[model samples]
Target: MSESEAGRITIDTSRPHPARVYDWWLGGKDNYPVDEELARKILAADGTAVRGARANRRFMHRAVRTAAEAGIRQFLDIGTGIPTEPNLHQVAQGAAPESRVVYADNDPIVLRHAEALLKGSAEGSTDYVHADVRDPDTILRLAGESLDFGRPVALSLVALTHYLGDEDDVYGLIERYVARLAPGSHLILSQVTQDLSPEGVARAAELFRRSGTPFYPRTLTEFARFFDGLELLGPGVIPVYGWRPDPEDVAAQAEGVVPVYAGVARKP
Candidate 1:
């Protein structure tokens, strides 16, 4: 919240936003009626929506913890949704008290809840950047104030890439961000995929498109392309729940299939 540029923030309740829709799926109360409507519609078409959201959250926690345990002390999380409990900062700082985190999101609602995200352990520092993921320069520049790019940092974009279509140069944007990181830095990502349930995923994509949000559900090979030059960690590019699952993730796997691909890689 402290890094936000001064301006009047506005919440557009007319159309559904991906972050708010995701919040609704996560059982958070920060979304509007339009967001809830879309979330319910997508859930009706794709029964795994809620489970996928939850699994993605777990994947993020596990990934951040892994990085923290590996001695990474700086984190940059883009497309950070609503202020969910045990957020990226909490998970990272929990593993390493001195972990520094910077969260970036374009949603006004997220900005309003930035104060909650800023509360980290006394040994660590947390900052929020009110910016879009497409503008990597702005985010990196502002986040640099708190994170040292000269050293290893963990960059996470969980359940976010699917919202950007091919026209957005998703891979190129990711490359730009990765190029700024030092060696040994980690890149954590989780994306919605159609490899598990093609029919349901297609229907869900259509629903999102009609609601004015562009959605792209990639196949396994396509999703794996995101880790091109990086070294993938163990359990490479598997289903969401299968990526270093904890007890919670183990139980979730028995519930249903979450057509999402998650992976963590290190810049060697």
Candidate 2:
């Protein structure tokens, strides 16, 4: 576990963390040698790994915009990884300046960089909660301070659930989080799946396991189950790069075979 003191989180550079490694992948400078080592190893094993990360970020941009355009003005993004450009609040507030966002993550590095996530449009509000995804109740309680549970909230779990194995009772965690939202709330998710590259993805998962970070890439059907009891949006459960691909992003279009599955659904 990392050390924490007086609201200043001290990170453990001795090991690799998911959020920091993800930061490295996004070309952020917050990662350590351990993180870079793991990232490089995964990149070496799966040529599409880095591209998959970038594609997921692009999907986040499009999905946030979609929710905003649909009149949703609140966001609760858990496992918010590390702050890459166009963070959730930035995208949401850009479209709707009054949009409120609450970001939750367990990583100390993310907490250290929480300041950037806090900067939202003057009219909007952004707050960070340092908590693990497993504790949905704490997240909901703390987030309640900023968001209104009586209104639709775009709950984002992008590129997060694959870390949770079946034993983790992943569905229960998701359901608990969703159950707190008012009707019309949305669930946005993206997870790595071996459907496209079984061997390579499994190898990467083992590497993560050895590094003490669990990675479980679910199948397409398993990934879709996350949206159970919710109304799925059209063009559902497709590759991250395939969802609302930008014509201007020629590379995203060319890389339509990204191994991550993503979808957005609304609570009935």
Candidate 3:
């Protein structure tokens, strides 16, 4: 595949970005000072912030593995933050060597790091798209080049959408993307929830706004609303950390919900 127009990407280091801040939270070196400052503030309120990022990554790993095992070989992962080791393609391709995966993100840092995320097994294909989640058409057009729309594809919007807030027509965006896929296509989503700690969530939301990134946490019910017309998977909508977890780590996640819930559903 041709290289994306990385020159078109603009990095505004004056303010913290969601991708870089999240990268810092995950303990990656791609983040900047502004990102670290905001991440530290969030961690001050929630000591498990780093653990939460790890859990979210683990959930992505499990979801991709489940999709690959279920024979879903094509993936369209939007809002794919900075490249981390064993990315979605790595997990899916490990389970199904021929899996075709497309990763998309708006951040220039993520685009610069796309080369690392593109590494895949010899039998699989991995590509990157520089686009925003708000523009569904661009993502669809770009992702379509790498994935087959006539077959089952997994659309992963992990740890995203929350950034869009309620006024962003989040559900409509999901429908726009999911409408292009064939039946049995999967919708894998993970979002922050404020049901357990509304006050802490509100504080975090304020921090994001002050950092120049508009983010709002959703309730469990609001988070589940995104799956209205789809068939939720077996485990159903649950905290990302607890969804089909191994017996050993389940209890540890129980102590702290991490204010995030995730689920996978299938289009009829």
Candidate 4:
């Protein structure tokens, strides 16, 4: 995959990284022992950790497909964890072969596996940016090389914001990113919430905090605020599995409720 100059890539196995922990939850082997340790701890605290990770992946697939079917060819996905199969670009290009996609993440391991993410349809283009979500300027500037902000681009940050604390200005950060999108662009988001399983979510957050990664599980009202000036689609801001579920998602719902809220909104 083509990448912007992000300086020397480094992987610190000394501590657990959110991306590595997420990869471990998704059953990927790219994570270190530290990541698996935290993943197991969180799973032990919350039985739905594995299910929640899978649900978020499915939600991303559906959301990207929805945007692609609606004629949004350009995509910018920040906080991309790892090179999972049927990733954002795969889903987008599956709907429209000419789709252009840019993936941004701070994880060095993701960059190491980025070559796998670049195997897209010949009709489309895929690029990766080794950057963090907190640095919107770098992400936007690098992604702009592959995507046109003048057109309707699909911006996705699925299951990512919960990792950012209030000091990160999460809401303001989202606004800054959204402000760059053109009219008809789509903003896709999914976040961890305590509204569904309060106790379990609380325990999980505590575990994350203890590991030096601050977690913020928002309530429904707080989560809804992220879509402030956009037009929410049908079944707006509901549980991850309930947002236009396919047969697979329908069966997943029977597994039990996952404490995550997801929504897709159009920039008017």
Candidate 5:
């Protein structure tokens, strides 16, 4: 759909955005040339970006399913990328039809695809907020309308925190939400890291910077800091492929480093 299709958001075809580039990597047709160009550059720099994206996607899927099985009925997913099939709400609501989910993203392309994202299960609820993660207050306010903060809510920040540079108060922003969550609340995340492939990771970051979308690749410890004080789930913070993977999937990811670290933790 074109930007004009959604009068609420402005489309900037001039520059590449994280969501659009991510969409392009997933082989979606909703991205513009700018996004494709940057995605190609990142791919050239590190042939594993596409693989990393797929690994991250699988991590999100697994996390949502596990959360639903763990009795999490509400989800607040920030930096929710494009409306990929079997999206977060779809996976969660599939497991628990009464699930309620709220998606927030700063990208205009995501806003344009928000309508599709709302097609959740009949017994479930879905809402979208065009807000940035930097403004945790705005996300909390909007998401609260759809999710009950008094109860446990799974906050999914998959493949997103890396975009929040060191200059951004990402830790503080995350802590703000963690503090507000109830005891059973969970933090689900997967981020790009330089632990395995330092050279490839640096090259990908530089490519993103050249494309005007600077991405920071953190170390494993740095990623773990985001979940400080929380109880880590089994398998802990490891490569997305290292998470409790299906036997067949584990064989698929045994080749090389995925360049992504992930984990699901519960707020005490």
Candidate 6:
């Protein structure tokens, strides 16, 4: 239930998985009934659970565009859930066709769909690693096969960090990966926060805890620490939909009460 075997993948439908449940929220068919069951429970607790999930994915799109437009050609994405359209590669390679991407996830389902993620541009490279975020050494080692650590890279951890509680040393773990990057390297992170829907988020967290899943939403201060030593990008640490939002939606969704906070930071 914690981690899947490397070569042998067996999905357990008895309990809910964070990735699968998230897939359900994203309207993907990669999830099971168990995932939907838990997802419903969460949705019942938080009315905007589905909305927040979609918003989070949009954040990924915008963030990747920002990175690509900034000339960051290498991308390392951890906790990559089911392969939805406009994936990291599609967006990054769309902007810069030569962009290389490495996707990592411990979920067996993600590995099963690795083929879809591997389809990168001929001018670029795409690879998937069956690993967990906690194992940064392995992730970085395998991802290095395609990406050049000597150059600027964008390390993206989208809608994923809240799974690691304080005891997991979220700050130290992230520091390990950022430490390996050269200057100008970027960190793209978006995580859920209780700032907007405190009560709803708390109830949802309790539900996840009872389901044997660890969900930890942090305060703005704690979340900002994850980007220490890096210069935060514009609209720093605001709601996921609020960061450099599209002109049309900026005023409308700007004040939208979403539960996630996103930010991009440069290593320099």
lDDT of 4 at 38: 97
- Give the per-residue lDDT digits (tens) of candidate 3, residues 58-139: 8898888888888899999999999888789989998988999999998989988888988899999999988889998988
How far residue 254's Cα lies from its native spot in candidate 1, in Å, is: 1.2
Candidate 2 versus truth, CA RMSD in Å, comes to 2.2
Candidate 2: worst 10 consecutive residues by lDDT? 1-10
Model 4, 37-98: lDDT tens per residue?
99999999999999999999999999998999889999999989888898888999999999
Q: Which of 3 and 6 is the better model by lDDT?
A: 6
The Cα error of candidate 5 at residue 231, in Å, is 0.4
Residue-wise lDDT of candidate 1 within 37-148, one digit each (tens)?
Answer: 9999999999999999989998999999999988999999999999999899999989998999999999999998998999999999999999999999999999999999
State TM-scores per candidate.
Answer: 0.98, 0.96, 0.95, 0.97, 0.96, 0.95
- Looking at model 4, the pairs that clash are none
The local distance difference test score of each candidate is: 0.94, 0.89, 0.86, 0.92, 0.89, 0.89
Model 4 compared with the native: what TM-score? 0.97
Give the CA lDDT, 0 to 100, for residue 16 in model 1. 94
lDDT of 2 by residue, 1-268 (tens): 1235316766889999998888888898989999999999998887788888888888899999999999999999999988888999999999999999999999987887788889999999999899999999889999999999999999999999999987889998899999899998989999999998888898899999999998899999999999989999878999787787776445766754568999999999
For TM-score, candidate 4 versus 6, the one ahead is 4
Error of 3 at 229 (Å): 1.1
In angstroms, the error of model 4 at 3 is 8.5
The local distance difference test score of model 6 is 0.89
Error of 4 at 35 (Å): 0.7
The sequence of per-residue lDDT tens digits that candidate 6 reaches over residues 120-173 is 899999999889899999999988888999999999999899999877888899
Model 6: runs farther than 4 Å from truth?
1-7, 247-256
